[model samples]
Target: MKSNRVSTRGILVTLCADESRVGMPGRAAPQGKLTGIGVKPIGEVQWQLLYRWLYGVVELLSGEHFMLEMSHLDSLCFEAFLQTFAQTYPHQLHLIQVDTCLST
Candidate 1:
């Protein structure tokens, strides 16, 4: 992954990733206010912990307006998890695709 800045509909997007290393994508929200950046690794064990935290966020935000960038993920299991999560939520969660690289 690389660092790139994009502006869309008055929203500023910052993408950060290391291609050589596999990690989650971080998003900076509009107006540069929200710390949209994803979790940062502290050690090997933290991945699972971070994932659980993300799951909680997904659950909490269920049905609410939100954006998800799945470009960094290529796991069927994770996709399935997201599908289930989406189904379990009550609000209408809108997924906004910001970049073309995630189409795959």
Candidate 2:
């Protein structure tokens, strides 16, 4: 039997997200020995590229269009990443679940 708790808006989407360290400083010269050179990073700003994907984001509802985005991580942490997503699509997100090994 189908439950009566189905969402009236639409089916929930499972978002896939990941972060990678990009624009990081190249390997430093070891023991004061020069090993060629490349573009150096500016200042102490750490950067990580955030990627997210969700199927059928636009086909679900009207006046609620949202798309994928790529930006540097604010604090280089998972929480910050989640916050950014939430802020971007505040009306779309309903629940958040982090992967954890737990017995019910």
Clashes of each: 3, 0
Candidate 2 regions exceeding 4 Å error are: 1-11, 23-27, 30-76, 94-104
Q: In candidate 1, which residue ranges exceed 4 Å CA deviation?
A: 1-72, 75-78, 102-104
lDDT of 1 by residue, 1-104 (tens): 01111111223322222112235544432323333469554433312212211221211222223234333444563465457545644343333332233422
The per-model lDDT (C-alpha) reads 0.32, 0.39
Residue 101, candidate 2: Cα error in Å is 12
TM values, all candidates: 0.23, 0.33
